[model samples]
Target: MTKPIRKAILPVAGLGTRFLPATKAVPKEMLTIVDRPIIQYVVDEARAAGIEHIVFVTGRNKQVIEDHFDVAYELEDTLKARNKTAALDLLEKHRPIPGSTSFTRQQAPLGLGHAIWCARDIIGDEPFAILLPDVIIKSQVSCLKQMVDLYNGTGGNVLAVEEVPDDQTQNYGIVELAEKINENAAHISNMVEKPAPGTAPSNLMITGRYILQPQIFDLLSKQDTGAGGEIQLTDSMLKLMETQPFSSIKFEGRSFDCGSKAGFLSANIAFGLDDPKLASEILPFMREMLDQPEAAE
Candidate 1:
């Protein structure tokens, strides 16, 4: 029987040290790409993928994230009183149904694996999805939805992967293909996290989306520190591989790593250009800046 992936874990406990100063006071997940926060995009993707429950693995000073998804009674009342139908509608559209969202604290700066473990009870006895909040994928269909479709067919662990240049394989968790399932999906025989240069089995790097079974919780519980002395999710996943089959799908989308300044700016521009209301204004401004680098100055 194929288990439905109804819950998703979003590990958002990391301090955004790379984007300090701005991130010093604000949680990076709350940083906005356009009008919506980065985390909103991630949540939207999960919702589109049929996830019924969302588990946010948060840390200190990340209360804003919980608040963002929660109802703002005062704001909504004020909008209603002022007859601001559009604003109220927008809020209603994005607000998760009551009891659909859950938040738990990681309590420390442990790695991604530990953050996820914090939500194990909430995700009890079910296959679930894990979406890294910092990575945003802009696709016609949500990236997680694509993975869910593949998971529904294959009935095992499924990861969203993308082909990277051979030279860049060491920067990612690369997978070794065992059998060619199709043009888009494959049976992964092995996974090497950040393999040394010239030694990567394949260039298909793991993107931030995953559909995993509940047994992974057991593996994560006993996982040791790896790479950075923090419980690494990759380490646990590799161990889980010994018992289960793993598959990958080259999803149709462009992913932006909003964790970095450059990727953040790129996401802003990409999303800005896609917004019908902003595209006409932003595209012209971007072209002007590019065509005449010093004219505006």
Candidate 2:
């Protein structure tokens, strides 16, 4: 039987240069979406997918993330004393079971491929999922769970993908499809990271979610720096495709690119609208913003 994918790697080593001052001291993954940090949403998704091990690839000044996952004993005790059952219950849900989570440091910003490689010791020989915390995906079904379901049947690498406009294909890793496995799935012929406009293989662009076979570690180990003088994950993935079956599953979800200020704000709004308590208050605020002449312009 194929080994079950029980582990996942989250790469959070990037210096959030886009958000500059705010990120100078804070990790971007700790930025709040509504009230929860971005990494919390990623962890929640992994938990929903039955991921038993979460290996975080971190870097300097990211201690807050580690603390966020740990039990806040002082805070919990105070809440308990105050008889705040609901708040205490919420905090408990954020705590991972002891020994189920681990962290490793990525001393340099070598890129996504290198970040994944940092978790090699923890991952050992099993297939694992990789989720980027910068991409907040909201879906009825967890994106990782959806990919895991596909991986079980296909028994190979699977990437979460979504169609982008032809002009925007250059901004993402584009996939070349060989055959249609189904309406929402296809055998990927090849993948190219950020192909120039009009030169892309297909409109389908890769999302942050991935289910990769452990064999990828070998390819990544010897990977030379590609694009931007960094070890790009897409390059190693392309090499792996040459020796194994690879496919892309079009995920059914709404993805928010939280790496940028605009995407971050938009995600906050989108999630706020989905909340029952906040929807009524948020709709009017959004409408007022829309009614402003500057907004129309």
Candidate 3:
């Protein structure tokens, strides 16, 4: 039987330069979309998918993320004293299963592959999931959960993918589709890292969510820098692909690249409309704003 995917590695060490001044002190993952911090949503997605342990690859100024997950005793006590049981209950709901989350440091801004490899010791020998906190993919069912369900049955290596425009394919790692696994999945014969214009095999681009075997660590270790001279995860994954199976789980959902200011603002609005309590008010406000003369420009 395939081992259940119980552990997840979250790479949160990136210096979010796009949001500079705000991120100079605060880690980008701590930025809130509506009420919850960004990483919190990633954690929630993992938990919803039955992930038992969360391994965080962190860096300097990322301490706030650690503190965010730790028990806030004083704050909890204050809420208790003020008779804020519901508020406390909400916090309690989101806390990781006790003793299930661990943190390790990636000392430098090397690359995504290196960040993932930093948690090698913690991940041990099991297959694991990697969640990119900044790429929040929204669906009625969380994207990670969808991938996890598929992983349980497929059992090799699974990546969450979505279609991108032909012109936009150059911005992402495009995969060559060989065969269809199902309506929402396909066998990956090859993957090209940001292929040149008109050379992409298919428009199906690899998005963030990934479930990979522990063997990827070895591949990542020997990976040479690619693209931006950083150890690109795509390079290692391709090497790993020679021996193992790789499939892309097509995710048809709204995805927000929170690494940019515009993307962050878009997520706020998208998620705001998705929220039941806020949607009724937010939708009308958005309609009114869009109808304005200034918005036409």
Candidate 4:
């Protein structure tokens, strides 16, 4: 039987260079999409998938991310004194149980593989999930939950993949399918990180969610710098794939690549539209803006 996945590793060590000046002091993961931080959405997705522990592989100046999860005593006290029951209830509902979350520092700006490797001890001897906070997928079912459901049946490395245009394959880590497993999944024959445009094996690009076995840690430890002079996770996964089965799940969701400025703005608008309260205020304004771009500006 497949061991139940209980822990998840979130590699949050990257410098959000794409977001630039805004991320100078604040960690990009702390940036808000609509009403909550990007990290919160990612964590919520993990929690929805039945993950028991959250191991955050963080870097410098990312303490805020840690604090966000911890109890805010003064704030809680103030709310309590003010008799803000609803707000207090919301905070209590969102807070993770004590000892369920752990954080480790990645002292260097290594790479995604190294970042996940840093949390090896915390994730000892078990299958763990990795969710890139940069990508937020919105759907009736969370993306990680879908991957977890797939892992339960397949019992191997599972990745969330999405179909992309052939010409756009060069922009992502494209996968070559050995065969179709089902309507929702395919056997991943090989993975190529950002292949040259026309040479892409297939147009299915890896979306940032992963369910990997503990054996990946050993491969990442000796992984050499690949595409960017840093140990790439895809490179290590490729090696692990030689011995282990890797499959892809075409998750039912709309993903927002929050790492880019355009994607970030799009997420804010999309999420804002999802909120009933906000939609009533945002929709007509957006329609007007579309109808008269200059006047709205």
Instruction: Tell me the deviation in Å of residue 140 in model 4.
Output: 0.8
- Quote each prediction's TM-score: 0.97, 0.98, 0.96, 0.97
* Candidates sorted by TM-score, best first: 2, 4, 1, 3
Q: Which candidate should be chosen as best, given TM-score against the real structure?
A: 2
Query: Which regions in candidate 4 have their CA more than 4 angstroms from the true location?
Result: 293-297
Full-model lDDT for every candidate: 0.93, 0.92, 0.90, 0.93
Over 4 Å off, model 1: 293-297
Q: State the lDDT of candidate 2 residue by residue for 52-158, as single tens digits.
A: 99999999999999999998899999999999999999998889999999999999999999999999989999999999999989999999999888888888899
Per-residue CA lDDT of candidate 3, range 153-236, in tens? 888999999888899999998999888989998889999998999999999888889999999999887857887889999999
**Lowest lDDT block of 10, candidate 1:** 288-297
Query: Where does the lowest 10-residue lDDT sum fall in candidate 4?
Result: 288-297
lDDT of 3: 0.90
Candidate 4 lDDT at 188 equals 94
User: Once superposed on the true structure, which residue ranges of model 2 sit more than 4 Å away at CA?
Assistant: none
- lDDT per residue (tens digit) for residues 1-297 in model 4: 999999999999989999889999999999999989999999999999999999999998999999999999999999999999999999998899999999999999888999999999999999999999999989899899999888888899999999998889999999889888889898999999999869999899999999999999999989578777888999999999999999999999889999999999999999898889999998998888789858657
